[model samples]
Target: MPKGKKKTESRGAGLEEYLEGTVFLDLWRDKMFLGQEFLTWLYLTSEKNNHFFELPGGDGVEAFFENRLTLSHGRGNNRRSVAITTTEEPRDPDWDEAYTAIGNNKRVIKGTLRVKAENREWRLTLPHDTLSPQGVKLSAVKDPAETDDLGKAGKFLDKIALTAELVSIVDELFSLFLSRRLSETWLTEDVPRLKEYLSSRT
Candidate 1:
């Protein structure tokens, strides 16, 4: 058999076993579950979140909401607080493959977010006499304007979509690597060719 055909057959068998109940299959499943759990945890932990826009020239703009929740009785009350921040980054030369070292020279809109929740106590008890119920609050901390020409752009980045795109990219890159299509100059040469092939499918 030809060497390439043998290698292909070997890889096919490995992949088949990976899709079966093999140890490698379990490892892959576990990793995927871990990643899903992490993302879900992040969403649940944050009380409030914001999205910002990145301008072309220098700075950016953002808009966010502050949430404050209060639990009150006749005389006693409790307060809880949280915050969310959203920001955008324009597609620029700086964020290209040469700088970010991710993959292609695609411009990414990045969002920076933070959330905090605290419980506050009341002095006197009112009609209801139960253990202190927590109050939830959320706020947006930073909103900086730009000195450059580019104004703020409003575009939401869905985490699920981004994750899917990432997975696709990884799958493609791995297939290329396994096929020995990637070399030291792969980034400079083969990457574009692979992209063209991918584009043709669309």
Candidate 2:
């Protein structure tokens, strides 16, 4: 949130690759899988696929994956590919072709994500590598004049709050995904179904 700041200091490794010699690594591994799997399914379910991720109370969010996709070699690595297509590749002719990228031993790391909730729409790029969102275009403020905090600080505060809310929506979406993704039904039922659907996409 610090805009136009320069980092003039260096620090140690913020995190270990595997969190070796600890019990947290188990959590880390599951988290890594959850993130990647969620991203993958989100892309697969986008744009009139009838895969609306249900919100907590009611209704659902319409998810759309943008044309630009970043694929990586597995989970942790510097290697990544950014494919910029002209059309809505996930929902159009190139949809089936997009899966071919993942089949080639690469995983979808992140992409331009479009999520619509109520009358507001959020567009941002979410990185699975660190769970950090970038280039966020958050929803419009419902009422900016009613703020107790004033001026730039107020605006920033509102932005941060809205951003956290948006991220919470994403977290809810991930939970919805995990319900099916972590189930034994996923392997026995959903996997075959998804494969059949993908095979039919062309």
Candidate 3:
């Protein structure tokens, strides 16, 4: 057998064996609601303060729900989900329907967010169950094809830096949410304000 093919098969077999263990999957299932709460908190918080967030590390970013939003209620056989989408650019999408759905006890299940940090922007689809960023569109950078080899490497590094920055931003933001969510004031302060925001919207 070819060396490369043998290595690939070994890696695949290892991965399959690893996935056969259910410990992490069980933990994820148990704690999946945290992701849902984070997304819900993001929407509530963004509705105030013009969708801008100041990270715990003192970095400022603006994030807005755009393009699509999904909300859900119940689980298992009783689960129901709805998605809201917009195609227009520049003009903000109206979220009255989503607000109403929330008022009816639905939680945010997924959303497309446009986030701006410094002068650059990124768009991603975030799902509540996993908190993974999907369909990510990063800000435009220098094209490698238009540059010399050295310049191409520099541009490639620039892209890598942007990706790392985005991951940091997401981690920090989620950490902030977890802090607030797990705090003593969440029920007394945040929940009341969140309720008020929904009440006003509906």
**Who wins the TM-score comparison?**
3
Instruction: Identify the runs in model 2 with alpha carbons over 4 angstroms from their true place.
Output: 1-31, 74-82, 87-96, 141-150
The lDDT for every candidate, in the order shown, is 0.27, 0.66, 0.78
- Lowest summed-lDDT stretch of 10 residues in model 2? 1-10
How displaced is residue 22 in candidate 3, in Å? 8.8
What's model 2's TM-score? Answer: 0.71
* Model 2 pairs in collision: none
Better of 1 and 3 by TM-score: 3
Mark the 10 consecutive residues where model 1 has the least summed lDDT.
120-129
Candidate 1 residue-wise lDDT, 1-202, digit = tens: 0011123554466676566766875565454423222222222212112223222222222321122111211211432212222233332212122112112222111112222212211111111111111131222222434223324443123223333332332233223333333357757765575455434433
Model 3 local distance difference test score: 0.78
Give the alpha carbon lDDT tens digit for every residue of 1-202 in model 2: 1122135442235455445566786776766755666777777655326646666545577777666777666434766565645464454634555677656555667888877766667789987755567899987647655654467987798788667767767766766777888788999987787666655663
Off by over 4 Å in 1: 1-157, 181-202
RMSD of 2: 8.5
Best by lDDT: 3
TM for every model, in the order presented, reads 0.18, 0.71, 0.80
What is the number of backbone collisions in each predicted candidate, taken in the order shown?
A: 15, 0, 0
